[model samples]
Target: MAKNTGKAYEEFVRTIQQSLITAEGMSHLKNIEVETNKKLTDRNGIERQFDVYWEFDLGGYVYKTVIECKDYASSITVEKIDAFIGKTADIPGLRLIYATKTGYQSGASIKAEQHKIDLLIVREADEREWTAEDGTPLIKTIQLNIVALTSPRITSFAPNVDTDWLEKQKDLNADIINHAFTSSLNNEIFISNESTGHKFSLFDLSHLLLKKIPDIQYGKGTFSEELDNSYLETKAGDIKIKIKGYKLDYEYHAPITTSSVIDYSKDLLGIVEKYNTGTKQMIFKDGKIK
Candidate 1:
């Protein structure tokens, strides 16, 4: 497939863009107009322009989406992403999209795992041709859209009492065990011993810890358990685990891949390092670090 130069990709993106325009009109877009070098003022009162911006009208509301086209069949940089988001942040109801001739970056999938933001790669594939029994070309246009779109929602962490309490230990990095532990012992409790005290205010801790775990369960094996928010992210590593609450009143566990192929160990450490010392030791083995 790589030898073919990814013709399948180019076809997909072209089709997707066309479909988006034809099916969904932009603000003031009577007909699908692909505009390049489109400029818009930013919140800082600075004028900024995009490589490609789509404007259409939808349901009496004008809508605009910003798109950046890339050639390298890889992912984008965080720095580049920060700039893009910054540009459109002020545009009310504005959607951001990316177009690339190559595939996505390794990090792109991670960012896109939820509401599928932060990654958009366009790879072209070879056009398929079909012939009749007589070997004559079939009269057909196969314009398919293969791009995926995610909702525009922020992924929150699952509630962890220990993580929440350890987050308060402060001034040092802490490692949060990916497991879910909920006890009716107390709505707000502190589980740490003297010299290192950890406080878990059910409300504050739940909300805070939930930002990292993304999924959690509260209750016993026999009773109705309360689940928390959902996280839309790709597993980057195995060392990190996530639990989240979902709509159907269920608690789900998301295990970060432990396989060596994934590089999430560092990322998880970075995330957990912002917490307490007591929790930090639990994550690091023999001070050699994972």
Candidate 2:
């Protein structure tokens, strides 16, 4: 017999709630509320508990969205969608969302479409490494895909405003590079121009260069001085970078790939060299870093 776990479905609900809360457009909404297993009274004086509830203020109006999570081995049936629709009718201006781990039946999809309910199929990413028949090791990684069966029809009630985060996607590559550099070095890197000096992290330099020259492509490889040499190249110019290991006190030795070469590289070498004391050594002990 299979073991009975009371909280077996709690993690699934939490992951869905978190994904919605952190989504590109959803996070910036004001007065956002996300809850799970919330009990409330309906219009007909009937009490009901929701699996997940989300509400937010947009354009001076509060919008409510309720989610029902089903973690079953079989697909959700039309009967379940009909029951959900009946409950949604009691709550005014409530958007009903149904999420299932095993997807929905064909009739269930039709029912959701008729009621304008949003259906989401949530699946966790599967990652594994195995040897093939030829003795070659292979790896596979699959990401979670939150597919919407029907689009929410409640947008007409609120103004169609584009999120600032979505607008930044055009410059996403540059933004990612900047964020990585600045965050990695804690905003200590600096760059000087013809007249003025500006400070940026490794990511900042990359972003700035990319912006100045649109054709440049940023690439990275495994840290190796002899075999692998990583560099940033553009139509204007190219710079060679070395992957040097810097040993911090009692910490893991971080690889500093870029040195002071141009306007961005000044003072970076000194800062990185300060941590390269070579006193702290990493010894492989029992297949672990020590």
Candidate 3:
């Protein structure tokens, strides 16, 4: 798994390099090399190869841009960034760029600015600015819809936030699920759109929905036949969807892993009865509104 992952990472890094140097011709950069295998000895005598390198003419001065791409489950810390910067100090006129899948942690931007280095942080999908329910403006990183049992495909757009690791994970999960699903189903997919709305076989929807909402439970019997007679049941935190023409249209809502504000309000009385008079068992915080 690690080998395959490394191969994919190398490929992705190369693709980006090609896009910048060959396709985009970014500035005065030339001869972008991906994993040229030019090994350097770290300050601790540990050897590491540069992930990418290119020559750029900055104000008629030829400078080398050395990049280190990191894909890790955790965010890059100041120590790691410092190490990468230290790794290139031996080479003269070295401009450093660090690209990470998980992004850098706090103080990274300050360190980069202090060192006059370019830091590129990439994540799965960029964030978008949106107003909250209370009209508070904020930005949220877009979460990709990764079907657990389907192959993931990424549609790229200019990211509002870094999402390198998220994107990688989504793509990897998608690839595995898609291959299995395609193989299991023999790749025979059909689509239909009628005036009554789109219609798909219960078998297909069942599989798709199962991947999408694995926690949801469907009642006994097939869904294709139950669509026409069912009405949705949304009480008890259960979503009972009844499709008029297909029995398979009855997909129970996914389990509630998290509760909403309304859920607490609706069940407040029950909670109060269950825990309010508990003889100091339920301790409220200083600022809490009991």
Candidate 4:
């Protein structure tokens, strides 16, 4: 099957013009109108049908632009260019443009140049011409990588204590770890070291764990951190306990990776610009001039 390369000539040009008006961020351009079989009379009261047309306001004056799209497989000839000039001659201040896929003959080019009729080759883009002035290759499609982050969570936090000092405190319970932790006003587990007046909590641990890693975990994972020669202040009569280390039941939340390809080939490929009449060609891609 043939590739889905394009649409009807008139509608295709209309679509391209509309997109450029929006993409170029112009405020004075009107919507492109496609009148394939419909006859719309101009100011001269003459019925003149067009393939595609639009208008724009500049220099305090509105300029009417029209495109005569020819879908013939063969190159346009001088006869066709002459016919177009005669057809549009009566219209005053009209900006006439002729577009085709195949191209035009030398005679047609001479006639079009003499008449100042813009000629363009608008069709599917080929690799040969898909390049910028800086020798950078243009692409019809691009792959975009997407990343979503999930913050790591703490499942458990236990402070180490000195058994010798535990026996001296009569107010301590048999399960010292349970009595050592207290829930904050926000219901988060919180504790502090009396020796250094440092506060430690589950929220703090979550942030600290992230800082220790080079990158976030790829998927569901676990981690345990331990410290030596440390002390923890407990809720049991604000008792200060010497801790050998800390036991943390931690699993880092995984970062999800996804990718998508944006194909501008279908969105736009042909009609880089009007190449005839000494007009320079340009293509807009990836939000920058490639």
* Ranked candidates (lDDT, high to low): 4, 2, 3, 1
Best candidate (score: TM-score) = 4
Error of 1 at 148 (Å): 49
Model 3: per-residue Cα lDDT over 89-176, one tens digit each: 6665677777665556767766776787766643232221134457786543333443333321211111111134335443345455
Ten-residue stretch with the least lDDT total in model 1: 269-278
Ranking by TM-score: 4, 2, 3, 1
Better of 1 and 2 by TM-score: 2
Task: Name the regions of candidate 3 deviating beyond 4 angstroms.
Answer: 1-7, 26-36, 40-48, 56-61, 123-290
Q: Clash totals for all models, in order?
A: 40, 3, 25, 0
TM per model?
0.34, 0.42, 0.36, 0.64
lDDT of 4 at 237: 33
Q: Report every candidate's CA lDDT.
A: 0.41, 0.48, 0.45, 0.66
Clashing pairs in 2: 178-203, 181-203, 260-265
**Which whole-number lDDT from 0 to 100 does residue 126 have in model 2?**
23
**CA shift of 81, model 1, Å:** 2.5
lDDT of 4 by residue, 40-119 (tens): 57567899876777767778897777778887889999999998887788877888788887889999999998988888
Query: Model 3 has how many clashing residue pairs?
Result: 25
Q: In angstroms, how far off is 4's CA in candidate 3? A: 7.4
